[model samples]
Target: MKTRLFRMGLAVLSLAAGFTLAGVVGPAMAQQNVTLALPAQSLLFAPAYIAAERGYFREAGIEPKIVYVAGPGVLTAVLGKSADFAMISGGIQIAAAVRNQKLVAIANTQDRFTTDIVVRKPVADKLGAVPPGDALARIRALKGLTIGIDAVNGLPHSFLRYLARKAGMNPETDFTITALQPQAMVAAMKSGTIEAMAFSPPFSLTAVNDGGALWITGPDVDLPEMKTFPYNVVLVRPDYCQAEAAACRGFTTAIGKAVALMRSDPAASLAALGKTFDRMEPEALRQSFAIFAKYTRTDLGLTEDMYRNAVAFDRAGGVIPETAAVPPASELYAPSLGR
Candidate 1:
C-alpha cells in the first residue's frame, strides 16, 4: 500500500510540473500581430519606427507591422478598416470625433508646438530685413498677403489663426490663407505664389536651407490657445480597441518604451529612425530628430486640460458640432498599459 501511494504521488507531481511549464510558455508563443500606420515623411512618426526596430514591440509580446500612407489617406484607412491604428495631427482626430467617427487617441507623441511661419527670403528681405525677435510684427505687416498651409483645417490653419489673434490680427481679415501640400510649399514660396506659410520640419528646415525666411515660430508668439499644445497622437478604431483590448494595451506599452528610449538616448533613437527613411542623410536625420524631439513626449498619456482645449478649439472652428458631447480624457485614452 505504501509503494502504490508513492507512485501515485509522483504521477500527480509530474502532471503539475507539465501544466506549469505550459502556462509559462503559452503567452510567449501566442504573441498577437498588430499594425500601425504612419505618414511617409514626418519625424513625428519616429517613435513607432524606434519601437519596431529596437524590438520593444516584440518584447511586449506583440508583432508590430508599420505601414506608410499618404497624408489624407491615414484617417480614411483607419476608418475603413484598412489599418488598425495611426499617428496623425490632433486636428484630424478632433475633426473625426466631431463627425462621430469611432476613433480614440491612445498616445500623445508630439505633445508640444513645433510648426513655424516661413516667408520667401526676397520678400522678407525687401520688407526691411525681418529680425528673429520681430517675427510677429512681420507676420502682422503682411496684411492681405497670401500664406500657404498644408491643410485648410489642420495644424497649420489652427496655429496660424492662433498666431494672428496673438499678433492683434484676425486670420480671416488680416491674411489670405492658401492650401498647399508640404512638398510644394517651398516651390510656391520660391515662385512668389505664396508670401509666407506655416510648416513643420524637416520641411521647415529644408525651406530655410533653401533660403526661405523664418518669420514666426509657433512658440515665439506665445499664443494663449496654443500653450503646450498636443501635436501628433496615436489613434485606434473604436472597434479594434474594443475587440482587442489586450493587444492594444501591449502596443501602447511598446510605444511608451520606445519613447522612454528616445528620451534617454536621442542619438540611438535617431540611428533607429534612420532605418525607416530611404536614402537617409546623417546630418539631415540629426536635424530632423532635434526638431521632432522639441514636440514629442514619452509620457504616452493625454491630459484633461489639453483635451478640453482641443475640443473647444475644434467646436469653435466648426470642425466638431457644438452639440457633440466632448468625451472625457479617460474615455479617449488608455495609458495604464504603459505603466
Candidate 2:
C-alpha cells in the first residue's frame, strides 16, 4: 500500500511539471459554462474531480465549477437553478421523485453503496474477535453507540439505519445517531463525544489516522442489497437537460470518461484527482480512491434495476415512506442523457 501510494504521489507530482496526457481528446465544440453542486468532498465524487483536472470536461466542451454545500443543499442548488447539475445520493432523488419533484438522474458515478463505520481505536479494542468479513457482526457490535453522520437523512444516516436494522436491532432505539460534519466527527471521536462515525473517505481515513479503526467498510462488505445501487449520481432537472441537451450530454460524457480513466489507469487517475485533494495524505487518498474506483460504474447508465435497488434501500432505511407513490425508473432516470 505504501509503495503504491508513493508511486501514485510521484505520478501526480509529474503532472504538475507539464505532464501532458491529452487534455483535449474529443471533437472541437463550443465550451459551455456549467456549475455542479456536491453535498460533501468525499472520494465518492472522485470522477468529477478527475474529469476537471484531466480536462475531460474541457474535451467535452464544458467549463465546470464544483460548489460544496451541506446535505440537501445540493438538491436546492439544482432546483433553484444555481447549478446545472448536482451529484447526490440516489435515495434523495428517489424521495423527491415520489413527491413529484422535477428531477432526473443522468448518470451514476459511484454504482455501489459506500461508507465506512469507523470507531475509535479504544472502542474497537473492546469489540474483540469480530471477523472483518462479517458485516453483520461488525454492525451488531455498534449497537447503543453514539454514531456521527453528516446529515439527518443523507446517505450515511440512511445507510447506518439500514445496517442497524439488518443487524436485527431497532434502528430508532438501539443507537443514537448525531449529525456532524466529517471534520467535526473526527474531533468528536477524538474528544470522546461520539463513539463512532459512518461516512466516506478521506474522513474515515483521517479518523483512522487519529486513532480510529474500521468497523465496517462499505466497499469491502459484499452485501447483496448494496451491489448495483446508485450511491453517487449526477442529477439534473429534466427540463434543463432537454433545453440544454448539448451541455448535459457533454457533462455526462466527461464523468463517464473519468470513470473509465479510473479503471484503465490507476496512477494517472490518482494524479488527475490529486490536485483536488492536495491536503490529504497520499496514502489516505490512495486508499480512498481504491475504494471508490473498485465500484465506480463503467457504463454510466442508470438502469431500471439500479434505480429499483436504490429505492429499496431508501425504503428500508425509512428515507422513503412505504406509502409514497414511487414512479417507474424510466420516469425518474434519463437513460439518454449519458454517452
Candidate 3:
C-alpha cells in the first residue's frame, strides 16, 4: 500500500510540473482570436473602440479584430461565418429572429431611442419655430416635403412612422422619405435639398449645430411597447458559440470590462475612439458620448419589454414573416459571461 501511494504521488507531481512549465514557456497557447463587426454610424459602439485601443481584450486572453459594415449587413456576415460576431440593432435582430435566424444577442449595448428628426431652420421658422410639439401637424401641413432616411425599412423609417402616428399624421401620405446615407443626409440638409431627416448623431448633432432645428426627438414620441429596442447588440453565430464556447465567453468578459470603462470615463473613451475615427472632433465626440451614455446599458442584459416591442413592430410591418415564431427573450439573449 505504501509503495502504490508513493507512485501515485510522484505521477501527480510530474503532471503539475509539466503544466507549470507549459504555462511559463507558452502563454500564448491559451489566448484566443475573435472578430467583431460594427456599423459605421454608431456612436453606441464607442465602448468597442475603447476595448480595441486599450488592450482590454489582450488582458482577457483574446485578440480582437473589428470590422466596419453597414448596419443591415452585420448579421449576414456573422451568419455566413465571414465574421465571428457582430454588433447590430435590436430591431434587426427581432426581424431576423422572426425568420428563425440562428443568432443570439450576448450583450445589450445601447437601448435608447437615439434617432431624431431635423428640419431646415427656415422650415422650422415657417412651422412656428423650434419646440414644435405639434411638429407632426406642421410637417403634415406641408405637401410633398422630402425627408431623408438611412433605409426604407429600418429603425429610422420605423421610428419615423411611429412619430408621425403620435403626431396624428399619416407617414405614408404626409411626407416623402428619401433614402440617403448618413453623411449624405448632412450634405443634403446643408444644401437645402432635403427639408427634414431621421438622423443619428453625430449627423443629428451636425445638422442642429449647422442650422437645422429639431422637429422631433425619438424619445418624445414614446412607443412604450418597444422594449429591448437594442440599438446595437453583440451577437455570435450558434455554430461558432458551440465550437468555441470558452473563447466567446472570454470575448464577452473583455467587452463588458470595456463597456464599464467607457461608461465610467467617456472622455477617455473618446480619446480611444479618435484612433479609429480620426475626423471626429473632440467636441463632437464628447456630444456623441453624452447622447449615447443616456441610453446605452453596459449591463449586457436584454430587456424583455424592449424585445417584444421590436418584434411586434417588425411583425406588424411585415419585415418578418407572419408565420414565424418569435423566440422568447431568454432564448434570444445569452447571459453575460462577463458577470
Candidate 4:
C-alpha cells in the first residue's frame, strides 16, 4: 500500500510541473503599449478620439499614448520610431511615399476630403451673390483675395491651387496663398490682413461663426473627381506591422469599432466626443462630428480607390510633381491590417 501511494504522489507532482511549464511558455494576454502621433487637435481624428475614450483600444489589448507633434513632424515621429503610428492626411502620406518613406496606411478614418474655405463676411459681400453650390463661381470670386492656410503644400493649399486652376485662373498669379497658424489666420482675417482662410474644422466653423462665410465645405459641396478619397488615416512602418502584427491589427480593430459606434449610435458617440473636444461649443462640435461620421469609411479599410483619388488630388494641387514616379497603391497600404 505504501509503494502504491508513493507512485501516485509522484505522478501528481509530475503533472503539476508540466502545467506550470506550459503556463510559462504560453502566449501573453496582457495589454501592449503604443504611441500615436497627431498634428493637432481637430475633428478629423474624431474616430481615434472615440476609440480611446470608449476603451476600444484597451479592449484590443492596447494602451495608446497620443503624442502631439506639430507641422509635418508627425512623419518624423513615426520614422524615428518614437511613435508606433501617426494620424495624417493622405496627401502628405502619399507625398512621403513618393520620397521613398516606408510607411503603409493600416486604417483610414475619413474617406472624403475635409478641407474648408471660408471668406470673411466682408469679402463674401464684395463677391456678391455667387449662388450656393456653384463652386466655380465661388472660386472665381477669390481671385484677388489673400487666402491663409495652415501649411504650404498641405491639403488646404493644394486644394486652393486645384480650385484656382479649375476656375480658369493661374494658381501662381490670380491670388495669394499664405501660410499661417490657425489662430493667426483668425486674427489676420479680423484685421483685414488675410481676406480668406482655408482649413479643417472647427477653425473653419469658428471663422464662419465669427462673421465669415463658407465658400467650400468638405461635407456639403462635392468637388470634381474627389468623391472617394482618404482624408485622414493611420500610418505605420511596414516592418513594425510585420514584427508587431498584433499591435497594428489591434489598433485597426479599435478604429473599426469606433467608426461603427459613431455610425450606429451618433448621439452617444457625439456625447462622448464632446468631452474630448470640450473647448469647442457643444453645437459646433456636434455639427463637426456629424459631418465626419457621415463620411467615415464603414469598414475602416484603406482601399486602392482611395489611394488613386488621393494621388489625383495631390497631382491637381501640384503637390506631386508631374515628373515624379508614383509608386503603386499596393505599396502604400496593408489590406490585411484592418479588421
Candidate 5:
C-alpha cells in the first residue's frame, strides 16, 4: 500500500511539473518594450495618444515609449531602427515602398487631407474677396503666387500639385512653390515672401487667427481625388513584426480601442491630448480634433483603390517617375501584425 501511494504521488508531481514547464500556469512575464515613432506631436494622431494615455498599451503588456521625429520624418525612424513602428502619411509610405524601403502599414490614419490651405491676408486681398465656398475660384487665385512647403516634394508640395491639376492649371508653370519650414513659413508669409501655404493645425489655426490668413480646409471643398485618400498611417518593420508579433498586434489593437474612445468621448480625448499640444486652447483643440477625426478610421485597413489613388497622385504629380510600379498591399502593408 505504501509503494502504490508513492508511485501515485510521483505521477502527480511529474504532471504538475510538466504543466509548469509547458507554460500552462506560471508567473507573468515582463512587459515587451517598444518604441513608437510619430511624425509630429499633433492632435492629428489622436488615436495613438488615446492608446497611450488610456492605459491600453500597458494593458496589452507593452511598455510603449514614444519618440518624436521632426519634419514629419517618421519613416526614417523605422529605417534607422530608432523605432519599432512609425505613424506617417501613406503618400510618404507608398513613395518609400516604391524605393524599396521595407515597411508594412499596420493601420490607416486620416483619410481626408487634413491640411488647411492658409492664404495670407495680403494674398487673399489681392484676389478681391472670392466666396469661401468657391474652391475652383480660390484655386484660380493661387496662380502667379509664391507658395511655401515644408519640403520640396513633401505633402504640402504634392497637394499643391494635385490641387492645381484639379483646377485645370499646371502647378509647375502657374505657381512658384518654395521650401519653407513651419517657423519660416509664418515669417515668410508675414514678410510677403510667400503668399500662402498648406499646413495642418494648430498651425492652420494660427495662420488664420494670428497671421490674418484665410483658412480653406480641403475636406470642406469638393475634391474627389483627395477624398478617402490614405494620408496618415501606422507602419511596422517586418523583422521586428515577425519577432515581436504579439506586442505589435497589441499596439495596433490598442489604437483601435483609442479610436473608439475618441469617437465616444471628446472631452477625455482632448484631456489626454492636452499634454501633447500644451499651448493649444481646449476649445480650439476640440474643434480641430472634430474636423480631422471625422475622416479618421479606427481600422488600419487599406483597399486597392486607396493604394491606387496614392500611387496615381504621386505619379501624376511627378513625385515619382511615372514608370515606377506601385507595390500591392502585400508589399506595402504587413497583413499579419495588425491582424
Candidate 6:
C-alpha cells in the first residue's frame, strides 16, 4: 500500500509536468453540443467564427452552433437557455443582472471601444474638417446638422450621444438624429444629407472607403470613459457554467487559439473570415481586419470597471432601473474550470 501511494503521487507530479498518463487518443467521444448567440454579423466576432471555420471547435471536442441575435436579445436568448452561450456587449450583461436575471461573462473579447465617429468627406471638407484635424472643433461644427445611427439604442447611437455630451451639446437639442442602416448611412453620407454616423466594424470600414472621414476613434482618441470597458464579452449562465465547467473551459481555450491565429496569420484569418463574410469583397474584408485587429482579445477575463460603466450607461439611458444600478461584476463571472 505504501509503494502504491508513492507511485500514485509520482504519477500525479509527472502528469502535472506535461505527460498525459495516456492511453492512446482513445475512441472519439460524442461531440458536446453548444449554442452561442452573437449580437450581429459584425467582424467583431471574427475570432469565434474563425474558431468554427478552422475546426478549432472540432479539435476542442465541442460542436458549436452560432446564431445571430440583435442587441439585448442575445442575453435574453442565453437566459432562456435558447443558447448555451453568447457574445454580446458588457452593457447588456450588467443590465440583465439589475433585472435579477443571472447571466455571467466568462470571457471578455474587448477592453476598449472599437467604434468611431465617421463623417462624410464633403461634409468634413465644407466644415474645414478635411482631416477632421481637431475632433472637438469638428464635433462643434456638427451643430444643427443631421447625423445617422443604426438604431435608437445601438452602439452607434449610444456613442454618438456620449460624444455630443462631451461637446457640451445635448444630442436631442444640438442636432437631428436619424436611424439608418449601414448601407443607408453610407448612401446618406455620400449624398450629403447626413453629415456623420457612428458604429463599429465592417460598417465603419465601409464608411471610410466610401469617402467618409474617421473623425474620431474611441480608444485612439484617448477618451478615459472609452478605455477598459469590455465592450464585447463571451457570456454564459452561472448555473450552466457550473454544470458544464469542463466544456466552458474548453470553449474559451479554443477561442484563445482562434484569437492567436488571427494575430499571427492575417492571410489565414482572412480566409477563415471568408467562410462567414462571404458577401464582402476581399479588399473589404482586409480593410475590416485592419480596423478591428487591435480590439480582438486572446485571453478572457471580466473587470469591475467595465461593469460599472455598462451599468451606469444603461441606467442613465433608463434601460435599467435604479434598484439594479450597481450590478456586481465579480459576482456575475464564473471563470471556466481550470485548464
Top lDDT prediction, candidate number: 2
Q: Judge candidate 6 at residue 221 and give its lDDT.
A: 50
Candidate 2 residue lDDT tens string, 104-164? 8888887776688999989899989899998888899888899999987788888888887
Select the stronger candidate by TM-score from 3 and 4.
Answer: 4
Top TM-score model: 2
lDDT of 4: 0.81
Question: Which sections of candidate 1 miss by over 4 Å?
Answer: 1-31, 68-73, 129-136, 165-181, 191-193, 278-281, 315-325, 337-339
Task: List model 6 lDDT by residue over 25-114, tens digit each.
Answer: 532445698998976678888878888999887777788999876666788898888999888777667766777876877887677777
Candidate 1 C-alpha RMSD relative to the actual structure? 5.7
| Weakest ten-residue segment in model 1 by summed lDDT | 221-230
lDDT of 1 at 300: 69
Per-residue CA lDDT of model 3 for 1-339, tens digit only, reads: 999999999999999999999888765445677778775656767777777798777767778788866656778888888888888778787777766676888777777677888888888777654345554565455446889988766677777766565556767887888888787888899899999888777778888887898777665544554445777778887556677877777777777777787778876777778876676666876787788777767777677777777776665545666577788887777755333
Task: Give candidate 4 regions above 4 Å deviation.
Answer: 1-29
User: Each candidate's TM vs. the true structure?
Assistant: 0.78, 0.87, 0.81, 0.86, 0.83, 0.80
lDDT of 5 at 51: 85
By lDDT: ranked, best first: 2, 4, 5, 6, 3, 1
Q: Candidate 6: give the clashing pairs.
A: 129-132
Q: Whole-model Cα lDDT per candidate?
A: 0.73, 0.84, 0.74, 0.81, 0.76, 0.74
TM-score ranking of the models: 2, 4, 5, 3, 6, 1
Query: Between the candidate structures 2 and 5, which one is better when assessed by TM-score?
Result: 2
Predicted candidate 5 versus true structure: per-residue lDDT over 176-268, tens digit per residue: 887766657767777778888877776666666656565467777676556677787778876777888788778888888888778788788
Query: lDDT score of model 3?
Result: 0.74
* Residue 53 lDDT in candidate 1: 92
* Pairs in clash, predicted candidate 2: none
